[model samples]
Target: MNRSSSSRAGLALIGVTSLVLAATGAPASAAPALTMTLSSTTGPGGGATIVGSVTANSVTPVPFPAGTNPTVQFQYVGTTAASSACSASAKVVSPIVVSNLLTTAGTLTVNPAAVKRISTTKIVFQVPSSPYPVNDANGNPSTVNPNGLVLMGGQTSSRWSVCVYDSDNVTTSTLLATATYTLAIKPTITSILPASSPAGGGQTITVNGTGFAATSVATTATAGGVALTNVKVAANGNSFTATTGPRAAGDGLPVVVNAPGGTVSSLDPDNNSQTNDPPIPFSYTNGISITPNQAAAGTQVTIDVIGAGFSSLTFDAGAAPIGSGAHVFLVKDAYVANSNRGVAECTGVSVIRDTELICTLDLAADQLNPANSATMPGVAIAEGAYVLTVVADGGTGAGGSANPTIVSSGATFTVGPY
Candidate 1:
């Protein structure tokens, strides 16, 4: 039975082999043949260049072999010292572009190797793939790196290589040309906003400037002798908004704006279009007083008062003790005080017409303390060497003066005991 099975298997093999030989009209042991060559290469910037050529040799063109994609690539491997092969490996910096071929010559492929730095004058590049048959107008395959192919900052150099490939899965690349070139870096800033505001603050305050990047802006201000609140900066680093308590009625309560760059002061330009030029300064005048200077304690003493330097002709006593319900005086004193302070009441005691009293007053206060008390009862009797101390209310009887207190001896007053 085993001998019979072996004879049957031999007959089947003979029949299959006869069919294969009849179909191809040739022996099954015949080997298929293929060939490929390298073409050309080019660089993007102005650095180095490579040229490749490829050709494929095969009996049949119909059903060509498999992979065939030709490309050219460039890389910067830096300079080299004398004897040794350039220290570094070549990096493919540009994308591969397929070369358009005119004729189908078998199959071919090209692959670029590392750049070879020979010296300042000469450099070598390797075409690791097969060679092809293709020529440029100059009878040589020309290679070029486009002018604006920027790898890092500016542009690529003219020195580079191009790769060529055929349909037979073969490749070849070569150094085509060389060029000299360069690269550059770009500029930038970091913040701007108000640094401060007033406590009893008003709207219409503006805070904006330029040159801000990653940092934050800060705003600050003093309100009613206290620090302001709700200081905020916008996310874009462009502007800032803040609300502060009412301002104390004096100069130098600054609304400071700060960033990493520097600090700037802000002012209310809404009321009268005032320019906040630094060191030039701005002011609000607290009115001054004199006359009927002697008033009995607890009596409603009405002294004439006059004011200047006010845009609206109104005074805001920031921290002054004088209340809103007090009466105003009608008198102007231009003979004393500078324009900024503009002659308000002074601190300490003084004499007036036939009276002596204690005078320690701050005109910036909102209301007088002790109610209607301006003098001590029965404190002194003097025919001479008596001084008068008068306080000004923003009312009819309050007299306005540049400087309220008379500094000269002729302005002295004496008071007799009640």
Candidate 2:
């Protein structure tokens, strides 16, 4: 071959190499970058409508042509795994699964049709109230492509990411751009209805709050030290109802509520002050009744009063069991006389078990009487229809001090004149 002919051939080879280099872009060129912005970062877990946009930093480097449409997807990822059969790892997270969200018939990928494109850089999307990932063709959790990364409601501080792909074939396509996001909402309790309940408890209470879960197993409510039962959350996941357990009469009994998204308590570390509005208040049952409604004055009479919220002091088995420091009185009007107060009918206030209080109504005509004067003076009264009342703590006669600890409504009775 002549030297001139060889040189021409080499120039032809160089021209062909230049053409190939021009067609396949250089490797150093940067991949397209994406910026994602959300309308809001926090909302109740049941379902929140999230509006956002993914803007490409450089349109030239995008995988698709300028006018070509691209696909986008949203996922709640606990932690990333190489395959769908995921195991626990710091970088990988278990999907937040609501009941029936990922059943045998479903898949984990959100609906591609739900993504609405307004322009090249803008799009709008709505997350369903629950049952996320509009489609999971095979509810089987074992595979890695779609359902494996789904997150359910009630999980707090979950991490979410928006992945842009060339097409809806997420199984085979590589992600063009991914933007990580956070769904941060703690469980909170705004109010509890029927704040005050009977001392015996067992009252249905309504709890209003944000991020309440319909799944009762994922939520909890308690009053005092007793656990609440029959808990049911509203469909919107904003409120719930539960029956309270037995609690003694008192003020400032803490109420605690815990949900999958967050936890709130009357005795929270942020604010420990307790009020009836937040905590559980137990009022006296006020259903006292006497064995005999009528009795003769100045005669020894034993009365049985049955009601609730009567204090019973626990004593050592060997030690003398002191009666509950309760005082009974016979007055013209329970409401009016209760304000004035009176001495107890008998000093020995014996509590039979926890419900019944037995006391000797020693209605002696005169104070000079010494019968049954073991501890207190026999009750001296005139014949008339009177109301019987029991007061805990120290009792005073006629303009006496009120016992702030415990008080009961009066029982109607007739004292026959002798």
Candidate 3:
């Protein structure tokens, strides 16, 4: 008798689970039996008035008694979910877009004028193009709004499911159909100046575009899988400047740009309408630096020169006195003559990736010129700061001979008495 009772208990539990799984006003075990069609998939500002139709597939009939209309509403959550947001909320929040930012914790607020029942299987919707009162959704008093993540925070897009409910939202309401909408505004790029730069980065590039955030930290840009640093947008929100990071020389690499976004809409599809989706033909040369810069002159010790695009810098025989028209020099801070520089001791070269170089450079006695060693005379070596420079002919994008193939970045190396 006990065994029979246990079997009966298990069947009872299964029936209870089924009823909960098919709860009304919420998602059910059935797949979305609805499809939403909009005039366009993208638009500017949550302020846009989207005219769309929600059609049911295998779902229940939305009862539209000649004078009655079922509710057609939007349920939104961060399209990009985060674990922290589930437990903690923001301490401070910004003002949000009024039209489309709805919350789940309070009374569902939707203007009756926004929806119209055309048939049994479909309902037409016209989202409010004008602003709604902020207090309407928060019960006219509460400050907490779940949709704030997209409207007031940094999230670019919130997943919105256009839900169709038969009659009022209650335990018995039949959920007909729901679909997620994809809306975006493409940021236009007018141009990217200085068309080309070294793959090893450190190049300051100016990107001109419209609809920028001006001073917001959300504005960012990248090229060739390398991030842009110190990104600052113009006060007018039309242009910005940033420094590039290291990247290997390649034929094609994606150029990405981002701006302050996430209000009733997406940050963007991240497509630049002007430059034809990533302006092409970027030129790269070579850039490198050295480590442990404080070394005495005439020191034959192994010196480390590290930076990116070093593979573009080569010697016929990675050997001492790399004389393949490739030269590394430690030019005096007050350089006046050729001898005012030290022919860096690059006795050996190591290769792995383009970002670093474990090579040897001879720190010969650095000299300084009063006028010219041939004119007034010069000092054998000066103990001061010197800038490291390289001459890599035929580098990655080494443009011309008059300018050499590589334009290395300036790295300071201090020199002392031998």
Number of the candidate with higher TM-score, 1 or 3: 3
Worst 10 residues of 3 by lDDT: 83-92
Expressed as tens digits, the lDDT of each residue in 1-418 for candidate 2 is 8999999999999999999999996865435445556675333332445565665554434344455444544455433222122111112212344554321112233345555656666555554333333334566433333323323443434545555555555344445545544434455666778765555456798877666654423678787666889988888777889886544456666677766544567555222345444443433243456788778876777888665556563321211112234456554554232343432254356778555667776666343211221223444566777667655543234343344223344467777864
Overall local distance difference test of candidate 2: 0.52
If scored against the real structure, what TM-score would every candidate get?
A: 0.21, 0.42, 0.41
lDDT of 3 by residue, 187-220 (tens): 5566667645565678898877665554212666
What lDDT tens digits, residue by residue, belong to model 1 across residues 125-191?
Answer: 4432223223334778523222223333222111222221122221222222222111111111112
Q: Tell me the whole-model lDDT of each prediction, alpha carbons only.
A: 0.30, 0.52, 0.49
Which residue window of length 10 is worst by lDDT in model 1?
A: 180-189
Ranking by TM-score: 2, 3, 1
Better of 1 and 2 by TM-score: 2
Which of the two candidates, 1 or 2, achieves a greater lDDT against the reference?
Answer: 2
Task: In angstroms, give how far residue 320 of model 3 lies from its true place.
Answer: 7.6
Identify the runs in model 1 with alpha carbons over 4 angstroms from their true place.
Answer: 1-204, 211-218, 221-228, 245-254, 266-418
Q: Pick the candidate with the highest lDDT.
A: 2
Position 255, candidate 1: lDDT: 46
